[model samples]
Target chain A: MDHHLILRVVTRLLVAPILLFGLYVQFHGDFGPGGGFQAGVIFAVALILYGIVFGLSRLRSIFPDRWVMRLLAFGLLLYAGVGVVSLIQGGNYLDYNVLLPSAKAGQHYGIIVIELGVGITVFGVMMAIYYGFAGRPPSIEDTDW
Target chain B: MTDLAVTLLLFFALVSTAIAIALLRSLFAVVMLSGVFSLLAALLFIAMDAVDVAFTEAAVGAGISSVLMLGTIALTARHEMKPKRWSATPLIIVGIIGAFLIYGTLDMPAFGDPNAPVQTYLNPDFIARTPKEIDVPNIVTAVLASYRGFDTMGEVAVVFVAGLGVTMLIGGSGGFLRRRYRETVLSRKDGQA
Candidate 1:
C-alpha cells in the first residue's frame, strides 16, 4: 500500500474534502437533506478510507481506541443531557421550547445540540466497528484474493 | 411520464440484482452486486422525493457495508460452499411469507393518497405548525429533532450500545477479560485435581 503512489496521492487529496463535506452535511442538515446520521457516516468514511490505504496502525495512532470509546459514550450523554436540561428548566422532558427566551429560538438551539450529539456518537461507533473488523488477525492473506 | 418509466426501470434492475445475488456462488461478486443493488435503491428513493433516505442508503449501504464485507472476506474464505442437496423447504417457506405480505399490502392505502391514514394523522398539523413552532424549513428535521426528540435520543442510545457491544466482542480490550476468566477457571480446576 505504501508503494502505491497513485492510491496514496489520491487518498491524501480526497481525505480533507470528504471530512469537509461531512461537516457541511452535519451543520446544513436543518435546512437540507442530510443530518447527523448521514454526516457521521460520511465523516467515518473519510477516516476508514485512510485506514484502508494507509493501514490500521496509522489510523489508530491518529484516533486511539480509548478516545473512540469515550466519544461513543459522550455522544449519547450529550443527547440525554439536553433532555435533562430541558426537564430541569420547568418544561417537559426534551421540550426545547423552554431552553431559551423564545420558543423558536429554543427549538433551533435544541435541534442543533441534539444533532451534534447524534453525529458524534455515530462517527465514533462507525470507526469503532471498522477497527473491530479490520484489526483482527487475518486467516487469509492479501494475495489470497 | 419520465418518473414512472425510470421508476419501473429501477425496480426491474433491483429485482434482477436480487436474483443475481441469490444465484451467485462467489461471495466477492455477491458483495459487489449488493452494493449495486443499494445504489439502485438510492436512485429509486431520490425519484420518490426522499433525498435524505437516499443519501443514507447510498452511504451506509453501498459504501460502508461493501467495505465491511470486503474486510470480512479478507478474514475468511472468498467463495461460498456448495449445498449438499437441493431442498424445497426454503422455497415453500419464502412463497408462504411472500403471499402473506402481498395479502397484507392489499388493505394498505395507495401511495400519496390524500385521505391515507398517515396524511390524515399528525402530518397535517406538523406541516401547518412547524413554521411557527420549530422555525425550520425542513419539516422532517423539525419532526425528528423537536417533535420526536425522545425517539431520536433513543436511537442515539441504541447506536451507543451497538458500539459498546462491538467493543466488548471484537475490540482488543475485551480479550483481556476472557484471558483472566480462563486463568481463574484453570486455577480452580487445578486445585480440584
Candidate 2:
C-alpha cells in the first residue's frame, strides 16, 4: 500500500472532500435525498479509504477505539434522551410538537437533533465493523488479490 | 419513455451481475459483482424516484459493504471451495421459495400505482400535512424524523447494538479495556518489586 504512490496521492486528495460531502449529506438531509444513514456510511468510507491506503494503525491512532465505542452509545442515548425530554414536557414520547413553543420549530429542532444522533451512531458502527474485520491478521497476501 | 428504458437497462445489468456472482468461483470477483449489483439496484431506486433509498443503497450496500467483504476475504479465503456434491434438494428449495416470492408479488399493485394500498393509506395524509406540520422540503426526512421518530430511534438502537455485538465478538483486544488491564498488571508487578 505504501508503494502505491498514485493511490496514496489520490486518496489524500479525495478524503477531505469525501468527509465534507458526508457532512453536507448529514446536515442538508432535511432538504435533500441523504440523511444520517447515507451520510454515516459516506463518512466511514472516507476514513476506511484512508485506512486502506495508509494503514489500519494510522486510522486507529487518529480515531481510537475508545472514542468509537463511546460515540456509538452516545448517539443512541441522544436519540432516546430527546424522546425523554419531550415526554417530560407532557408530550408523548418522541412527540416533537411539544419540544418548543411553536410546533414547526419543535419538529425542526427535533428532526435535526435526532438526525445528528442517527449520523453519529451509524458512523460509529460502520467504523467499528471495519475495525473488527480489518484488525485481524490477514491470512492472505497482497498477491492473493 | 427514457425513464422506463433506463430502469429496464438497470434491471438487466442487475440480473447479469447476480448471475455473474453466482457463477463465479473467485470470491473477490463475487464481492465486486455484488457491489455492482448494489449499484444497479441504487440506480433502479433513483429511477423509481426513491433518491433517499438510492443514496443509502449506494453508500452502504455498494461502498462500505464491499470494502468490508474485501476485508473478510483478506482474513478468510479468496476463492470459494468447490462443493463436493451437487445437491438438487437445495436448488429445489430455492426455486420453490423464489416462485412463492414471485407469486406473492403478483397479488401486489403495479409499480407506482396511485391506487396501491401504500399510496392510498397514510401516504397521502403525510404528504398533505408535511409542509404544514414539519415544513421540510424533503418529506422523507420529515416522515422519518418527526412522524415516525420512535421507529427511527429503534433503528438507531439496533445500529448501536450491532456495533456493540461486533465489538464484543471480534473487535480485537486493543481498546480501553485492554489498556486498563495492562495497567493493572503493571501495578501488580510494581507492588511485587
Candidate 3:
C-alpha cells in the first residue's frame, strides 16, 4: 500500500484502542488515578485523530460544531448546577452527602453524578476545542457524514 | 534489591527521555518524546507506589497532552526547521539544573518504607478515620470533595471564571458572532442543496 494508505490504516487501527482505554480509565477512576477529566481528554484525542485522517469537513459532518458547543455548555452547567443544588440541600458547597436525602447514598450519588457531569463536560469541551481548531468555521448541517 | 533496581531503571529512563526530548529538533517529535517523558514519569510514580497519580500522569500528561499538542501543531505548524543560531548556553544551564535536581535526590526518603517522612506524618488519624466518618471508599475522594471541599469550591469557581473569560475572549458579544456563523452555515447549506 501507498504511504497515505498506510497512515490511514494505522490511524484507523489506533482509534478504537484509544477510545476503549479512555472509557476504561473513566469508569475505573474511583479506585485509580483515572477520572472524568483525564478520560475526557483521552476520548477527545481519538476523535481528533479521526478528524485528521478523514478531513476536518468530513469529521464536522458527523459530530458538528453546534452540538459539540451545546454539549460543552451542558457539561459545565451540569457541574455547576450540581454544586449549587448540593449547597441548597443543606450540605456545604459540592458536599455530596447533601446531594441526596441520605448521607452515604447522597455522597455516592453526588460523586457519581458530578464526575459523570465532569466527564461529559470535559469530553464535550475537548471535542469542542478540537472542533474549534479542527472545524473552526462549522456548518449548520446535522447530516451524517 | 528488586525495588531499587526498578527505581533506578525508572530514573534512567526518565533522564534519557528528558535529554532526548531536549535534543529533538522537530516539533512533532518533541511532542511525542515529551509524551515518553510523561510515560516514564508515570512509571516512576508507580515505582514509588503512587498508583493514582501514575494513572493520571500516564493518561493525561502522556496521552491527552500529546494529542492536543499534535492538534495544535496540525492547526498551526508541523515540521520545525532547525534554528539558524542554536545556543548551547541555555542548554547548559538547564542541564545543570536537571543535574542538581538529580543530586538533590540524595536527601529524599527511601521508596515506600511507610515510615518515611511523608508516610509517617500523613495525619494517620485522618487517613484512618476519614472512611468511617465520610463513608467514601476512595480516601482521596473524601479528602477532595468533602474535607478539602472549600478548596474544591474555590477551584470550581476559578474554572468558572476561566470558562467565562474564554467565552468573552472568544467573542460572546451578545451572540452576534454565533448568529452570523449560523447564517453563513445555513446559506452554505442552502446553496449546496
Q: TM-score of each candidate? A: 0.92, 0.93, 0.76
Per-residue CA lDDT of candidate 1, range A1-145, in tens?
7777999999999999999999999999889998899999999999999998898889889988777877888888888998899999999999999999899999999999899999999999998888888888883354665
Ranking by TM-score: 2, 1, 3
Per model, kept true contacts as a fraction are 0.78, 0.90, 0.26
Could you give candidate 2's per-residue lDDT for residues A1-145 as a string of tens digits? 8688999999999999999999999999999999888888899999999999999889889998778888898889989999999999999999989999999999999999999999999999999999988988763356889
Residue pairs of candidate 1 with colliding backbone atoms: none
Query: In model 3, which regions exceed 4 Å deviation?
Result: A1-24, A136-145, B85-88, B99-123, B153-193
Q: Worst lDDT window (10 residues) for model 2 chain B?
A: B171-180
DockQ for candidate 3, C-alpha atoms: 0.28
Candidate 3, residues B1-193: lDDT per residue as tens digits?
A: 9988998998898889877876777777889889999998988888877777887788678876776676567556556777789789988998899899989998888766777876778658668977676675667766665666556545544544444444444533224466787789988999999
- In candidate 3, how many Å is residue B151 off? 3.2
Each candidate: chain B TM-score: 0.88, 0.89, 0.75
Instruction: Report the CAPRI category for model 1.
Output: medium
True contacts kept of 2: 0.90
List TM-score (chain A only) for every prediction. 0.96, 0.96, 0.79
| Candidate 2 ranges beyond 4 A from true positions | B176-193
As for TM-score, the candidate ahead, 1 or 2, is 2
